[model samples]
Target chain A: MKLLELQAACAAYGQSQVLWSIDMEVEQGAAVALIGRNGVGKTTLLNAIAGVQKLTGGHLKFGGEDLTATPAHGRARAGIGFVPQGRHVFPHLTVMENLTVGLAALAGRKAVKESGIASHIFDLFPKLTQIKNRKAGLLSGGEQQQLAIGRALAGQPRLLLLDEPTEGIQPNVVQQIEAALRRIRTELGVTILIVEQYLDFAWSFAEAYHVMQRGRIIRSGSTAMESASEISHLVNI
Target chain B: MHESAFLIGQVFNGISVASLFVMAALGLALSFGLMRVINMAHGEMLMLGGYLAYLTLLVVPGPLGILVAMPVAFLGAAFLGGILELTVIHRLSTRPLDTLLATWGVSLILQQAARNLFGAIGVQVVAPTWLDHTISFSTGILSGLTLPDTRLFILLVAALILGGVALLINKTRLGLYVRAVNQDRPTAAALGVNARLVDLTVFALGTGVAGLAGVILALLGPVTPTVGQSYIVPAFLVVILGGLGSLVGTTIASLMVGLFTALIEIYVDVSVAQVLLLVFVILFIQIRPQGVIAVRSRALEG
Candidate 1:
């Protein structure tokens, strides 16, 4: 089943069109990476999907339901969880509180115990459980990244959208995140649609890739490229 | 010995005054802290609340009526604030200066309305029986200390309110939504939190609390259309001194301003103390703009 589909989607900022006629699709439980150069519509597209920015023209469908006019919070309740760029964690709230915030979407769901959610999150990232009492702002960048993902997961989303998770983090932490994403995909079967710039980092786990340029998807296919060098050439100057 | 007793009595007076400052400042702090809007009509909200209290006295007599009027006033003011939010404040939310000017306009309109309705003169809320008398106290070292029953009652009431607000902000789900919106409205909205609804609710809550403060002030003196004018500046000073958007900072700052005003009044002119307090706040901000309990956030940064 198609988890998400964007049909001829277009968005603009005060006369300057950032995303125009973009078409994209992700199947249920699929791991898809969206890549493009700097200043492209990657972030805009993600924002549109997450309902942060309303599309001027397009049809958005998730889980076989229309979502074109839904607000951001409404999108979350419909099982669309977003982890925005720069790890926008609530600095004052504790690690546990940040995670519980994700539960805002799961309020009406049956038997969604808070403790059970914590345990589930801890089971995914044990490092979070260790410092769960600490303020989110005090955490290291990598820890914050984990908390961001963990917080998104706490929403119990069927589909997770991540924007530039490894933007400024160390290499070792990136590897940890990759491992976690893989586990999330295979074990939990949560559909993921990621916007990433790092080729090797994204290409490793992504089952498929889409290249966005000037607000349009120009290229998309199976992950089997000729070589990493070719993939690097495809991504950057 | 008598000098020492007078000093102690003055200190008690300061503490009593602090409670009123805390109560009066609470709503303004909440509105400014969460929404980042300078609500110039915040004082009007309090004035309206006082009028509500005075009106309540006509229907329900005595202290029991005062108790009932609190929730009633809160609801009425909240409803009025909600209307303003929808009509004016919400539209100008993105423009802080515009919001300030718009709310200031609203304040003027409210004051005129109050004057036309209640007249330029003020109405008095009859003091509750329990708070109508002064109480005398004496410790081993200090004798002949007297505390006004009104101040005592108000002090306890303000403390209870502070406790309630703290608990609500820290422990409740509504608080989670509030804090989330306060820190980052866009991110909170993206997380499926109703940021707009939260803003409206907070606006109402703040105005409701202001109504309660008006009722308390009415007990001390008459409720006039211009009563809020005298309060608006001091309440704003307390909010800013406490730190923008920091509830704990507001609480501590209100007490500090209250006590300092009381202390300085003993030795200096009341007007001089006001000027000095402004200078102190200016210096304090210059040194530590973040405040006593500022949260770590990059929400304002590019």
Candidate 2:
């Protein structure tokens, strides 16, 4: 069954339509890659799905519930975690504080206590635990990315939406992120929907791939079957 | 010997005045520090709180009135803050400059309304009998120094409120969410922090604290329709000089401003002292554009 589905989703910013009837789906525990070149509405699509941006038309269903009209906070409450591009971590807050911010959003104090989400997030990113007291602004790019992902995981999201997780990141740190994503998928059973301009890094973790161009999906295939040349040709890398 | 005694008396008077300024400025610091909203009408909010305290005394007689007025003024200002957030502030959330203008307009309207209802003349606020006395300490060379019980009460209240606000921001869950939103609003929202709601609550909390300051102001002296205007510049200076959104920075700045202003008033003419303070603050800003404590770097990133 589809854990998340976007049926002919149309979105816009102000007057210009940025996404044109975009359709996509991700099954439970599946790692789906959204591969697209710059300005192909990848970020807009992610924003729309996360309810940060309004949809011009069509519907969004998460865990079989229609989420088209839901506000961004409501979407988050309904378990849609988003890691926006540029790893926007709270600079004023320490790493632990950033993680606790997400934990505070649990349905109630009881839910937070039951989840032990902070500990689990720290366990996933051990580096975060070491520098948990350090302010997020003081961290390096790689550390910020880990804190960003850890913060999202603290919400215990059913479906995680990551936009350009590897963009501008060092290659070594990219490997660490891949390892973290693998752990999230294998250990926590968190489903991920990632938008990527970097095909090589994305294909390593994603089980399926969707290629978008000019605000619409041009191709879709299993990651195991698609060749590197095919991805390059689709994205024109 | 007599000149020394008079000088000491002037010093005590300055300390009292400084304490009041600190109270007024702390709330402004909290609001500007977290939201980056200038809240030009912050002084008016403080005046409204003072008026509320005055009104509370008229309605409820005796010491109980003073006790009730404190929380009432706070909650009342908080309610006003929440309303402003929904009607005006929410609209201007993305427009910082517009918020300044809008709140300034609100301030004018509130001041005129107060003048119409309460009259332009200052209303005398009666302190409880226990606060009307003076406390004195005597030493060999300095002789005895005297302080008003009311001023001491204000100082203690200011200290308590500041401590409470610090605890609320640092230790509590709500504080955690506020810090998160302040640090990175969009990211906080993505993490399910409910940024909008948090903004509203923070604004309300800051306004409520301002109202409490108002109640304390009323206790300190006569509360006129234009009383808030007197506090506006000092509060802004405290907030800006302390840094944009650092509460601790604001508190320290407030104390410094309070003491500095007090000392200046004693040695220099009051008007000249005011000008000097402004000039000093202007120079200080040039030196540290980010204020005494800069906000975390990520907070400034788009």
Candidate 3:
């Protein structure tokens, strides 16, 4: 079953239209990569999916439910989690506090405990447990990324959208994040959609690839089938 | 040199006044600290609590009147705060300066309404028989200064309220959500924190505390429609001096301002003392522009 679908999604920032007639989908438990160069509406696509930005004209559905009219908070409540670019963690909050903030959205403490989902986030990103007491702002870039992913996972989301998780991180941290994403897909069964500028880092983790240029997806195919030259040409690597 | 006995008396008076300021300033600080709103009308909310207490005294028996008025003032002011949140504050959340202006307008409207309904003159609030007495302790060199029971009661109540607020923010899950929202709105919203609900609840809670302060103020002395204006400046001073959004800083600042104002009123001219205090505050702000305790947030960088 399709976890998320965007039919001719169109969006804008005030007067400027950034996303034009975009269509995309992520099937259940599928790991999809949105690969594009800068200013190619990659982040804009994630924002639209997360309901943070309004669609000028389009249809957005999640698990077959029309989510076009849903607000960002309602989308969050409906299990669509977004890890925005720049790892926007609450700097003043402790790691535990950040996690707890997400946990508060659960129906009750009993449901939270019954799910054991928060522990799954911690298990995926073990560094979070050690730095639970430390403020998020003081964390390293990689730790902040982990914290950001961990925060989203705490919400027990069915569909997770990550925007440039390894954009500015070191190679070793990128590896850790890739491993965490694998575990998230295999163990927790989360449908993952990630936007990335780096083809090498993203191609190994994503099952399918969508190449966007100038606010439109120009190519879509299996990650294994796409040639390195084609990928380089698409992302201008 | 000031006489030891005189100094002791002044200290006692300062402590009592500080306790009162702490009551009023803590609520103002909490509201602004968490919400980043000046809530210029917070003082008026306090004044409303005082007026409610006064009105309650008219209907209830003397001793039980003040007791009954406390919760009523809290709920009344909380409801008003909630209404303001829905009507004005909710729209002005992103615009701090606009919120200050809008709430100030609300405060003016409330004050003028009070003036029309209750008359412009101050209405006296009588203390219950238990609080009417004074307690004195004896020392060898000089007799220890006496303190009013009502003042002592107010002090205890302030301590309790501050303690409760501290616990709520530091320990409770709701507080964790508030702190998260204060630190980063976008991140909190992404985490499913429902930033709007948290904002409304925090504003209402802060205003409720203000109402409690108002009730305590009513018990302290007379209340007038314009009474809120008097505390508005001091509340701002306390919030800024203590550090933005730091409860501990607010408590210490409240006591310091209270004691300083009381001492100045005693030894120096009240107006001159206020001027000196203002100068000191200005100097302090110049030294620590972020406040005694800074509001830590990534958004603050840009």
Best by lDDT: 1
A40: Cα error in model 2, Å: 2.4
- Model 3 lDDT, residue A234, Cα: 69
Runs with alpha carbons beyond 4 Å of true place in candidate 3: A108-117, B142-144, B297-302
Best model number under DockQ? 2
> Each candidate: what lDDT?
0.84, 0.82, 0.82
Tens digit of per-residue lDDT, candidate 2, span B1-302 = 44566567666675666566666776666666567788877888789899999999999978778889999999999999889888998898789999999999999999999999999997877998878898765665455667788888887887888788889989998888888777666667766777778878888878888888889888877899888888877878877878877877777777777777777877799899889888888888898888778765435353
User: What is the C-alpha local distance difference test score of candidate 2?
Assistant: 0.82
Candidates 1 and 3 compared: the better one by TM-score is 1
Q: What is the lDDT of residue B260 in candidate 1?
A: 85
The TM-score leader among the candidates is 1
- Candidate 2, which segments miss by more than 4 Å at Cα? A108-114, B1-15, B296-302
Candidate 3 docking category?
Answer: medium
The docking quality of candidate 1, as DockQ, is 0.53
Query: What's the candidate order when arranged by decreasing lDDT?
Result: 1, 3, 2
Per-residue accuracy of model 3 over B150-173 as CA lDDT, tens digit each: 888988888888889889999997
Q: What are the chain B TM-scores of all models?
A: 0.94, 0.92, 0.93
On DockQ, the stronger of 2 and 3 is 2
- DockQ (CA atoms), all models: 0.53, 0.56, 0.53
The alpha-carbon deviation from the true structure for residue A68 of candidate 1, after best TM-score superposition, in angstroms, is: 1.8
Clashing pairs in 1: A73-B192
